[model samples]
Target: MFKQLIPIALIAVCTPALAAEPMVVQVKRLSLDTALKIAQGSIAACREKGIQIGVTVVDRDGTVQVTLRDTIAAPITVPISEQKARTAVNFNAATSAMKDRANSPIGRIDGLVMSAGGVPILVGGSALAGGVGVSGAPAGETDEECALAGVAKVQEDLDLAM
Candidate 1:
């Protein structure tokens, strides 16, 4: 009886410690409307430069939200754009800045592209909201410019939300 009571006492003593607080987290997510605006803005920017391109927007989880290809863009640009966007969101940085890692082992990971066209979308210039990628431009820098233009289109709204 004493042995059973000791075990029970220990259980009672440890139970409170085992009690965990309920975990409920809030996270910001990109809306479809915003994703469309980003994709359209990127395409418009490329159009102004006489470049037909493919644009992709991905949420923070690296899930694609929108993909837009200009009428004359090459079909290959679609997958490349999506990969770039996924890479940006996964790494939480612009693909252009990761040039050194392009040939590294990490870059070899599936579904990730280390190209310069991917740009992370941030809320209030801090919280990462998503990523945008542009492909089919003459140069990667040009693609990145278009991606940045798209993010700029919603910069004010993002800032205000913070």
Candidate 2:
């Protein structure tokens, strides 16, 4: 009885030590400055083509971080641009490619648009920082180009900062 009681005591003492603790993770996210820069870059790209457009930047959680609309852009562009950004971040893929999958199981869900002009911003080794979307271009391809330009404008900054 004494030996059995000693083993039980030891087991009880060790059980708490073996218990798992919740993992703590630190994530690097997009900053307001970076989001603004990307949005502004998108706007500038469209301006360079003499087109009025709206741009939106969304965080990894598909929350809008920054939204900029050109003075001449149509009001409809605002929501369209925001949706595009949300779509990109939701899938971690370019919205341009998702266009072909609009009817597929993975597309056209969660109130996101699978059209072109949305691109994801990844950092810290595949970590999704956010996304940028541009709208109001005459063509989806043009919109995508402008979005890409916006990403390029701040690519170096993102890479270095993270």
Candidate 3:
């Protein structure tokens, strides 16, 4: 009887340990307000340079959060901005860093714009929050700078949240 009780108690004690871990995990998400702020910041930066531009902000999953295009910006800039943002999020790096990959097979993948206009938005220095893409600047580097400015707009908030 004692042996039987011991086995039962051991089973009960180990059951919790054997149980499956949580099926879902909590993930940080970019808020709409923050996304809008990023987009506006990017546009403002470009405007300062007398460049009409389009800006897109996408979440970590490469989903568009907010897109803004200046009235005089070319219509083509909208799609290009989105592609740039998606590329940044998909590659988890700034598009400028991946410029060498532009002619590679990986870059040939649809929606992956391996240009310099895309910048990743990182939180707490490590967490990938999202990405920003700017288009219509004379140079890709300039577009990237605008994107960086947009990310910088909320950088302090992001760091503090962490």
TM-score of 2: 0.83
> Which residue runs does candidate 1 get wrong by more than 4 Å?
1-22
lDDT of 2 at 161: 79
lDDT of 1 by residue, 23-60 (tens): 67588999999999999999999999999999999999
1-162 per-residue lDDT for model 3 (tens digits): 898899899999998987757868777989999999999999999999999999999999999999999999999999999999999998889999999999999989988899899988999988998999999999999999999999899999988987
lDDT of 2 by residue, 13-105 (tens): 998876765468677788898888888888888999999999999999989999999998999899999999999988899998888898887
* lDDT, each prediction: 0.94, 0.88, 0.93
* Model 3 C-alpha lDDT versus the unseen true structure: 0.93
Number of the predicted model whose lDDT against the real structure is largest: 1
Q: Which of candidates 1 and 3 is the stronger one according to lDDT?
A: 1
Where is model 3 poorest over a 10-residue stretch in terms of lDDT? 18-27
For model 2, how big is the CA root-mean-square deviation?
A: 3.8
Error of 2 at 122 (Å): 1.5
Residue-pair clashes per candidate: 0, 0, 0
Error of 1 at 107 (Å): 1.0
